[model samples]
Target: MTAPLPPLVRLPLLALLIDAALVVLFVLIGRASHNEGLLGTLVTLWPFLAGLVGGWLMIRAWRAPFSIAWTGLAVWAATVVLGLLLRVASGQGVQLSFMIVTTIVLGVFLLGWRGVVLLVGRARVRRAALLATAKRMSTAG
Candidate 1:
């Protein structure tokens, strides 16, 4: 059997999965707000999902899924644009208010997690550096 992948390798894959889940969450929340049936999930899901896939493919997101500026922005843009376009082509409503709401909410969902990850990673690095410096000083003194 192949050895388990390292955490570093697994992280990007995890990020992709998170992004997809967030997109689905966005759809579900909107549908619920509108009193739409859960049975109609796929009808609402495909457009945003397609846009999400397009975003991932366009940026080769696996290469840098942790990057907010790189992966997050591109993914947000593609998902919103394509989702809107597909919604129109599919004869769904596309009011200005809905467009604004979708853009803001998806931006927060897609990019917010990445921002949190970046902050956590930075904190860990700083803590490690401080510990190392303290150790060196103690040993020297």
Candidate 2:
């Protein structure tokens, strides 16, 4: 069997995969709403993908991939802003209404998952603490 990846490598890889999946999902939903097919969805995905790469670089997102403050906010902002800029440059429409919708939708997609992860992490920590406390009490008594 193959060896498992170290945390340094594994965390960033997982973060990138999750971020890419969310971006693709955003594109897929938007395309479906317009009754567009796969090719059109992929065509629309390029600018957003570019923005995601730019965001990852800008935030050095791998450092704290799961942190909402470090990764989630920066990634969301960069993806929406840079994505629209690239889209505009590519002669794609960037109307105000579309921008607003894109911002809200992408924000929810990107930040929502991070928020869930944060809650779960906190819960796990709390549970561990409680378990440790109980073990100590039983041993002492």
Candidate 3:
């Protein structure tokens, strides 16, 4: 058996990393053009942070089922919608196309990673089960 990781969470940590990366990207681009206003900062930070938290929740909720693709897609769509609504609330002029694209990319990556993780974990479990069965058969024989 593989040793357990530290008591610290793995998914949320991953989520934070993703959030930070995206936020930095947005900040850099905004700063480049001097468009990094308070509204822009809010728009960029809110979605990214929310995405991280949402991704963490989705992973935790569906970790057992391990269906990354669909769950990731769902969470992505939901979070994007949530983010856009937030933007609307803040009176930011957001375009629908932008939201769609953002949702697609984020959903695929966030959920896709989880799906891959689930696949690897499942494979490991299956391998372990097969090994145990083989051992049992050998001893029985």
**TM-score of each predicted structure versus truth:** 0.90, 0.93, 0.57
* Cα lDDT of model 3 by residue, 1-141, tens digit: 978655355654554465446545544554456566876666566755565466547656334323555555555565666666666786766787767666666665656666667789889999999999999999998
Model 2 misplacement above 4 A:
1-4
In order, the Cα lDDT scores of the candidates are: 0.91, 0.91, 0.61
Cα lDDT tens digits for candidate 2, 1-141: 999999899988898889889999999888887876877897899999999989999989988988888689999999999999999998998899889989999999889998999999999999999999999999999
Quote model 1's TM-score: 0.90
Model 1: lDDT to the true structure: 0.91
Query: Rank order by TM-score, top first?
Result: 2, 1, 3
- What is residue 64's positional error in candidate 2, in angstroms? 1.0
Predicted candidate 1, C-alpha RMSD: 1.8
lDDT of 1 by residue, 26-109 (tens): 988888876668667778888899999988998888888989998899999999999899989998888999899999999999
Report the C-alpha displacement of residue 74, candidate 3, in angstroms: 5.0
**Candidate that beats the other on lDDT, 2 or 3, i.e. the better one:** 2
Question: What is the alpha-carbon lDDT for the whole of candidate 2?
Answer: 0.91
Q: Candidate 1: lDDT of 61?
A: 88
